[model samples]
Target: MLKLSEYTHNQAQVESHYLYKSLCKWAAKQPHATFIVEAETERKLSYAQALAAVHELRKAFGPAPRRLLLALPSGIANALVWLSALTGGHQLIPFPAGARNEEKARIAHRYTPELLLTEQPEEAEGFGLAQARVMTLAACEALIKQAASLEAMEPLPGQVWLTTSGTTGEPKGVVLNEQQISWTAEQVRLSHQLTPQDHGLTVLPFFHVNAPVVSLCSSLLAGSTVVIARRFSRSHFWSWIKRYQVTWASIVPTIVAMLLETEKPAFLPGKLRFMRTGAAALPIPDLLTFEVRFGIPVIETYGLSEAASQVVANPLPPSKRKPGSAGRPVGISLRICQPRTDETADLCDVRAGETGEICIAGPSLIRAYQHNASATAFQDGWFRTGDLGYVDKDGYLFIKGRLREVIIRGGENIAPREIEEVLLSHPLVREAAAVGRPDPIYGEQVVAYVVVKTRWSTQLAQELHQYAAQRLSQPKVPVDFIALDTLPKNPTGKLERRLLRAREQARFTAQDVASHTA
Candidate 1:
């Protein structure tokens, strides 16, 4: 029978002892095991080679811990640094090689590390920034000829910091501790069923907790080979999967939708055993289409950076995979909280019928936002998820939508996801976005921006509006629809609603003036 896995962890394992030092624990038993297969060049690293490389660097780092920002290709060297950072006992900030100069500078300054680890180990010429002792992967390689016995250095192991996309504000660091990392990895391993036999593929950026902790750490701890993508490319996805024989991978909804289209998939490696998707709500229609084509399950899950990356993942058994739901809570307990004048209270069994804010509490949940003191807390020390959903009688959790996303019109509330989903059903629509524009009389107006498919024409827009009107209620039908070749998208490929809103407001203002003059 399935039950919540214990999250109990000993800090000594992931934190107190250096990262690479304990990596030796996992490696000693399987020194010859292959741990990495570089995605770009197909170079493989056995456990012994990986361990030896890290040991060489550990000796060079010397007594005092160095703040090493990991910068290398997504291959053996990259994998070695990651293990070395943890086991070798350095405070690690894994930097993405492809990050923009501005983003790189911003993050580097924020971490304030003493040393920068990169493939090109040199003092950068024009950074105009604080100088960190630059050490390249090449420099570390040269030191191998004159290595001395190096003891692992344990770090001041708290607070592994992560940053948000900063779409809202200058990204505040999301701090995590060693217990959080080790505990979260263990929970995710059991939740995702990651094991040595599982061939994992990672396209998510290592900078994010979802990829680093959930995908990378979870897989490695289970002794699985993770195929790391230097960067995520829709065109390269199928080829990488086929080449790596990836059994499991994680993706957001955008990539899944692209893969679901009726073109011949570039199935370079063939199909994965299953896909785990999260970070945003996935549309159900595309979800169904993807499952049918791939012949593998798309396991929708719920997670947050605050909660160590994963909370609820759909279990693997065919019977357990629900087409629309994000599946059940995995390695954690979920509850719906009844909103009160003062605070929200947990409704764990929630009668299996009503909607409420989906709140989760478990060892994986963050103690609190790194330094955000003004935060909402519900009963049992659970963070208010700001999301509304309910579990059905069958225990399948269905996310209605985010609380902030619900729109109000004529004193009635409407979910934009529902409207967007309906609009997306129109064959002429290639992509759709719904936003509430400020209105004088109605308080808020529902507006949609659409991208038409190549085969479709301007006439299809009218047909789509009519199509939505017939199926959806009056308030739900968009009052104004604008056609675009494409919508602004975020780095992760999710539609940038905040940008779309600015555009919508501009159009609305222009229309109002034109109407007044006419």
Candidate 2:
């Protein structure tokens, strides 16, 4: 049996340049150990079986390395296809299964992948790819089964092509190499202290960088088991945990908020260890309420696609944890830098407790964006995260908000998070978002959108306005409160503040036109 300490020590000594080597080592040592589970179908795959499957699936792509675009949903098949690409040294471009054909077509045209792999070949009709370039999973599986003998080839490192969430603007392509992926997986494994005994659950989509690095690759390196769900289901979340004996789960703030609204399980699973939250800012009130109600610790984390996933994560247990903090940098060098007007100038570090742009440089981070998009983000060997945050005296990071998302009201700069946090503190508020609206006098004024538990009315909006005023400064108070059935969010459950800003701008423009007509 591999003890936790022994596994940790072994992981430290192993070379992490090639993830395929590590997978092969695990298959050789623990051939029969379970590796992954399909939560919906309850199908299991062992390490040895997974390796064999990878070898078989690699044959479909031929011996030559090519860029393969995968548009499959989250499941065991998607995991296997990803592993095949990684081990076979083929670059994999993953697109969301639920994305519209037009969106997928735009990505395909931009990247120009050599092959397109999807569950339904019909969906690729308008992708502008030839029929020979399109390959369905079923067809690939059939080819694998028919092949009498697989060709012997050395497993080489591969790359992952991803894009930013594009909440602020157009998404840019990010390419992560094998070493970067392996490095991030090792860092995540070390931070979480995962071992062969642990079982993880992944509800985040496979296409997102979070699932592949934080859940799949990390678990693979640890020789642990992970349950891959089709999607996040509030009704079945607890049931899956109890049935699979899951110890940890990787989720976003949206999932946490939704889970809080649902009825608590009658009895919490004893084997479950913690819930990891990332990809967005989680309201402190919701975090506290979740811990108090469920008796499970929520480990808040911070990461971006360019970093290959996790850059900071809170310590698990038996250590001092500061709520609302993204913990400390793990396997990376992080510094808060003062904003500069010139893009070519050097960036100076900000003093502790002062908010500035969060910058990171590490082995896990990408050097540049694909197609040279957003070149300004990388400078002086550091990737400016474009997020405003500060490191405490104790070295914990507190994220304020996005640097681009700041609201300037009459020359007073305000962080939207401050207003949103105050609004979220209200019992009636379910979700809150703040954006800057165009103002004739102040240039930009603070506006808030909120989802309430009860009905929304003019009186309710007035009450929220007064509630916010008490907790915020005069300038920080929202000039207008708009009740929404729900806040606009991206596919990954991140609030799309840019969409809100656009909506406000459109409304203000319409009103201005009406006034002129009158």
Candidate 3:
């Protein structure tokens, strides 16, 4: 998570506005223009229809919440509510629909939302709220439809409250204002060269910042179209792209790997341009394999909830793109700074090609976490990204690993991503995550969790270790490789290093105790 700063002076001068108004304006100009479509049902909505639907949903919310909890599955209905909430001057807090009831209750209690909206009303009951307080998508749509009218209020830029991906630890709510959100969308539109003629397929969930700001909001802002899928289906991914004539899509590395694993299609989609992958460090082998297998370039991007969505991205075409780099800063000024030890102390910048904590200062960056400022550190107007990376001479950023995820073995810091990347290069390895285990002799030992295509065996493990050794330093090779059917990942497909470390500690402690007793 990045420690954000106050909005820049230029950001304050920027005309920060809501997407709802933009949608309405687009609807009036092009009533028949398609805005979104359901890939499975083929149900579609033009700009006019979508605006009307959003208005109807907005009218049903008797009174808007200071903060509204969105806990619906991915769909047009979910999008409508989100747009309505943003335009209606309500703070938005999105909850993952797949979360357990207890988890939902915990988040609900922490955020203390005035309204809980979901497609499944039964799920809202977990929050212990009255039924009347919980609104369903169908129920919101069932409201009486009045003539479509746009009511202008004193410009109150709505704030979008987001949670950290919680991939490595507990999630925290980050607050982003309208300027930040709008700037991010515009950056994505400009950086990707989006236009009204273009169409995007969105397989990412609506609850995340990338889906809304990058895929949906950016498309709408550019007067383009987006197709929303309920969930990512590797089998149907290519078919959806071809059917919708989707030019590009926002995706994660997990989906890319799955697509590579599936049998290649007879031919690529005619109109498909490229696939954008982010939210995790893309293994170089997978990136090259994906491009070779599909005949489409994989544009690696870098973003976080704190930055709204996009901070950097590989250019689409006619521009050189490094295989493993996240590309140059698109709409932000990035710097490599010595890791901050105190919030009040100023940190010096690292030289080019020097690995240090990545930091950023830009219009799109968030101002602060919802209510927790102590959790992050900001210095000299730059927010520490907590990610360890370096910039090449070409100004391309290469992420090494996360600050918290670094493995300190015998006082020498080893980036887990370097080890994971080496293991993933192996033909048999499908998924890989590296964690540090406590070692009395060396302080910590490197261990890897791998999901292999073939049956796990000691010989296979030895082969992987040898392969890693040839590429990585001797100290970087994993002491033990545990084969699992799958590695645990957060909903956004980010490897959960903390969980793996915890599991390793538990197992190691038990073994140590048993040996002492014996």
The most accurate candidate by lDDT is 2
Choose 2 or 3, whichever is better by TM-score: 2
Candidate 1, backbone clash total: 10
Deviation in Å, model 3, residue 458 alpha carbon: 21
Question: What is the Å distance of residue 401 in model 3 from its true position?
Answer: 0.9
Q: List the residue pairs that clash in candidate 1.
A: 18-87, 19-86, 19-87, 20-86, 20-87, 20-88, 21-87, 121-136, 242-268, 242-269
Count of clashes in candidate 3: 0
Q: What lDDT is obtained when candidate 3 is compared to the true structure? A: 0.76
Clashing residue pairs in candidate 2 (N, C-alpha, C atoms within 3 angstroms): none
- Which ranges of candidate 1 are over 4 A from the true structure? 1-22, 60-66, 71-73, 98-105, 119-128, 140-159, 165-170, 261-271, 339-352, 377-380, 404-518
Q: Each model's TM-score?
A: 0.68, 0.76, 0.75
Residue-wise C-alpha lDDT for candidate 2, range 2-69, written one tens digit per residue: 11121111123336445677678788889889998989889888887777777877877876478888
lDDT of each: 0.65, 0.79, 0.76
lDDT of 1 by residue, 163-276 (tens): 542112223446666666766777667766676777787766665677777776776678777777776677777777787788888777756765665465645344367888
Best by TM-score: 2
